[model samples]
Target: MAAKPRVATCSLTGCFGCHMSLLDIDERIIDLIGLVDFDKSPIDDIKSFTGPVDVGIIEGGVSNDENVEVLRSFREHCGVLVAVGECALTGGVPSMRNLVPLKECLEEAYLKGPTLVGGAIPNDPEIPLLLDRVYPCHEVVRIDYMLPGCPPSADVLWTALAALLKGEEPKLGYELIKYD
Candidate 1:
């Protein structure tokens, strides 16, 4: 039997709704597992890539140094890199920070927020440095495809993955493309 294509996925700086939508495929997940092998994906609890992957699915936008590092690694190791959901395509809700200066945003969250009990802005080697603005995945690296939706419906994800697994371009129908 031929080896199944391998897929890897990661979430960067947005809400994890996209990953949740992947799970929403429900029992079809069994079929997906039969078609593809997961590598370096939270779906499989694999923290690092074992080898080159056929596809790399990325959720969320690039907002920090670590996100950039991971995204670049994905580009280097995956044959096809797909940016899924609004965040990866256009920075989504997190991009709102682009309007406000990063400094003020940090101050509000760590020092002056109403709920905070007074804390210093974090500055540690362990914490990844924030970018001046959030960026869509494509802005940081070459993306082979993009699925635009707040959390692209499960059907959309299934269609895209199925097409890619079969070595064809995904042709999403009007009903499958949604921005909400």
Candidate 2:
């Protein structure tokens, strides 16, 4: 029997709505489960993947220094990387705040403002300090494919998943966020 393709997935710097939307595929995901072996899906239980996966799905923007590393790592590990949400493709709503300076934004949040103690500094280096702008995933690293929607509709995700599993490029040329 041929080896099933492996897939890795992650969310970098945005709300996890896109990840949750994958569940919108209902039992169709069960069909997909048979086609590919997910190596690093955040929804699944795992940590630190180094496998040579066939596809990688990134679902958020590159909002800081760490996001840069995440994008690069995914690119290095996966053969075909797919940016799977508006945040991953065009930076989505998070990129809108790119117009503001980082210091002023921080000031407005903690110092001379509304939050409790005015400020509390974290000591961890992994914690992002904030940048002048938010970058989409592809801007930080090469993306083999992109699906642009705040949270792309389930049909779009399912179709993309199926095509990808079949070793064909998925076309995300249609809209996926409307329901009437």
Candidate 3:
């Protein structure tokens, strides 16, 4: 028997909707589990990569120094790196902040917001610093594939994963692909 392919997944700057969509694949995930082993994913509650993986699926945009480091590490450790969802492919809604200056964005949240009493923009060494603009994962690393959607449908994810695991390109039908 062949060794099962190992897949790792991570989320950066978006809602975890992409991961939710993955779970929507339902019982098909059992078939996937039989073919591939999961590593370094929120699904397994693993926070760090334990070994090199055959595939890396990254969700969300790069909006902070930490995201860049994580993405780069994924690139280094995975044979194939896939950007999942609009955030990871094109920065999605988080890119809206690109139209505004970072300083003003921070001020609106910490100092000028009506809900705050004594909130201050945190600049602690322990906290990850925000980047000037949200960027797609590919802008930071060489992504081998991109699955685009607000949250890519479960069929789209499964098809892509299955194809890639078999060393073939994913072929998506019109219904499986979405721009919105």
Q: How close is each model in CA RMSD to the real structure?
A: 1.0, 2.3, 1.0
Quantify all predictions' global Cα lDDT against the true fold: 0.94, 0.80, 0.93
Over 1-180, each residue of candidate 3 has an lDDT whose tens digit, in order, gives 887899999999989999999999999999988999999999998888889999999999999999999999999999999999999999999999999999999999999999899989999999999999999998899999989888999989999999998999988888988956
Which of candidates 1 and 3 reaches a greater lDDT? 1
For model 3, the stretches where C-alpha displacement exceeds 4 angstroms are none
Model 2 lDDT, residue 71, Cα: 79
In terms of TM-score, how similar is model 1 to the real structure? Answer: 0.97
For residues 104-178, write the lDDT of model 2, one tens digit per residue. 766666665765584754447867756568988877888988876778888888888888877798875546543
Q: Candidate 1 — which residues are off by over 4 angstroms?
A: none
Global local distance difference test of model 2: 0.80
Q: Clashes in model 3: which pairs?
A: none
TM per prediction: 0.97, 0.90, 0.97
> Backbone collision count in every prediction?
0, 0, 0
| lDDT (Cα, 0-100) at 30 in candidate 1 | 93
Worst 10 residues of 1 by lDDT: 113-122
- Considering only N, C-alpha and C atoms within 3 Å, which residue pairs clash in candidate 1? none
